[model samples]
Target: MVVLNAVIEAAGLEKTYPARDRGGTPFRAVAGIGLRVERGEAFGFLGPNGAGKSSTMRMLGGVSAPTAGTLRILGLDPAAHGRRVRARLGVVPQDDSLDVHLTVRENLLVYGRYFGLSRKAVRERAGELLEFARLTEKADERVEHLSGGMRRRLTIARALINDPEILLLDEPTTGLDPQARHVLWDRLFRLKQDGVTLILTTHYMDEAEQLCDRLVIMDKGLIADEGSPRELIERHITREVLELRFPPGEHEQVAVKLGRDGLPEPERLEVLPDRLLWYAEDGETALARATAAGVQPITALVRRATLEDVFLRLTGRSLTD
Candidate 1:
């Protein structure tokens, strides 16, 4: 069955910023991108810096107008009905924009008031959100006193003041420690369990794999590939990869001899500054053959291919590069 109930829809969506100087061409931040967010699916955009993920998010949030395309949020034209569309969305920006001077509870209450909510209703919701964010004990504390993760959670909580149907989180856990990131991820997981449609943008491979049900890998304002994490890995790369590290200056020499008849014949071979990677169905066999061909490595490891490999294979570059 072809389901058509989408929380956000865009076709040939584009955005261009005005030229920095006169007679210069405008910058195309987004170029003819199309996407659909299902009612309850966690959709994500995975990309490095300058990939236009944030631009697209702003358009969908009803804050930016498309240059030459269509965008509908909650089944309304965002260009014309942006205010109405924004009422149904909760947005967490890349940076935590909490008011440091305001108490945690006060921040939430203030945000709720902007949505035209009654003071009584806002206070009730703020109490619930404080518990949801695990900041009940810090409810009356100044936001400046909170940790990075706590402030992030509070920002997310403030976004939920109107009980939005769709939530947009941009790099939600960028600067947190591992434990704090996990806590935030758990909260997002719970929101997904409650059937809140989530749309997020991130450069972290594991984060995307862990959170997104499906995602698009974007590069230079265009989508390079789209699929679930496992699906992208299975489709774009071998099942396993063998990493071989020889002496620093010897990688080039090894690369010349790799994937030849006398040595390991892998599906693909990549030579980085520090290591040689062999991609194949069986990493052990590839390593064994390479060793037999007079290839001695200082270190060798065989691990299953992941979304990072898929990203590299598709973009001809690492995710961070």
Candidate 2:
């Protein structure tokens, strides 16, 4: 049974794929994991490639069956009642699977018909969705002629044809220009305000930080951690980070030098190829202390800790595919 007020629930979810080669072990895409998403809140699965995010999303959307687990969408078992569950869920896949031959309005209308709506009803909803997607003026334009952002919006509009209670977005803003991304974000934000539950999967740290009320960090088919963006940062990282860039190929050496040279022991020190991140409550003070210890770098910067730091701390890797 679904938990009270939970739109989606999973326990020990697992998905495995047959190996390409004969006599090889099966590939386990999703390890045992559990999560619950309540109504009207935006939840996210944040991870890089091969992190099982897409596999988990496919199961949640009823597109794939879990190998071993209990899964529910809207209080119904997806495996037992896929049609019923899917009817109330909108899916915006990573690819905008819009029909290039169809006009923008036609796309929505056709998709609505698939849900068994009356022709008249579908047309009316299509018009409203076109406006919601900011594509009303382009309603008559064929999708092939529209810009990338417009096509993405049309895809979203089509998914809403059934008035689903939950919407699943997979990398919603990938490949869009910044301006287009912001416009799409505004539309999604409005949906949140209107009490639509959102489940999204993305590798973009900034996107997760901006949109997710709570998120899970997944890696290697397992979840590393879960929490609200700010909570994760506060829990796993310091308040501020001082980035020090040393000479070429010296970042590793500087990581050791900073601590030994009287730099106030930071909460943590992360050494990357490009820079050394000194995690501390007081970034400026750390910088001053480092300077006093006679350490000089090519460049220095101080910035607030973020979700990326939390992911890095948990998974020991960047959130890039």
In model 2, where is the ten-residue run with the lowest total lDDT? 257-266
* Global lDDT scores for all candidate models: 0.90, 0.90
Over 1-321, each residue of candidate 2 has an lDDT whose tens digit, in order, gives 534499998999999999889999999999999999999989999998889999999999998999998998999999899998989999999999988998999888888988999999999999899999999999999999999998888888888899999999999999999999999989999999888999999888889988999999999889898899999998889999999988889887777777745545447788877788899999998899779878898899999998888888898887762
The pairs that clash in candidate 1 are none
lDDT of 1 by residue, 1-321 (tens): 756589888889888999999999999989888888898889999988888999999998999999988888889998788889999999999998889999999999999998999999999999999999999999999999999999999999998889999999999989899999999999999999998999999999999999999999998888888999989988888899999999888888887776433443338888788788888899998888888878999999999998888888878888888
Error of 1 at 76 (Å): 1.0
Candidate 1: global Cα-lDDT? Answer: 0.90
Which residue runs of candidate 1 sit more than 4 Å off their true CA positions?
Answer: 1-4, 260-266
For model 1, how big is the CA root-mean-square deviation? 1.9
TM-score of 2: 0.96
The TM-score that candidate 1 achieves is 0.95
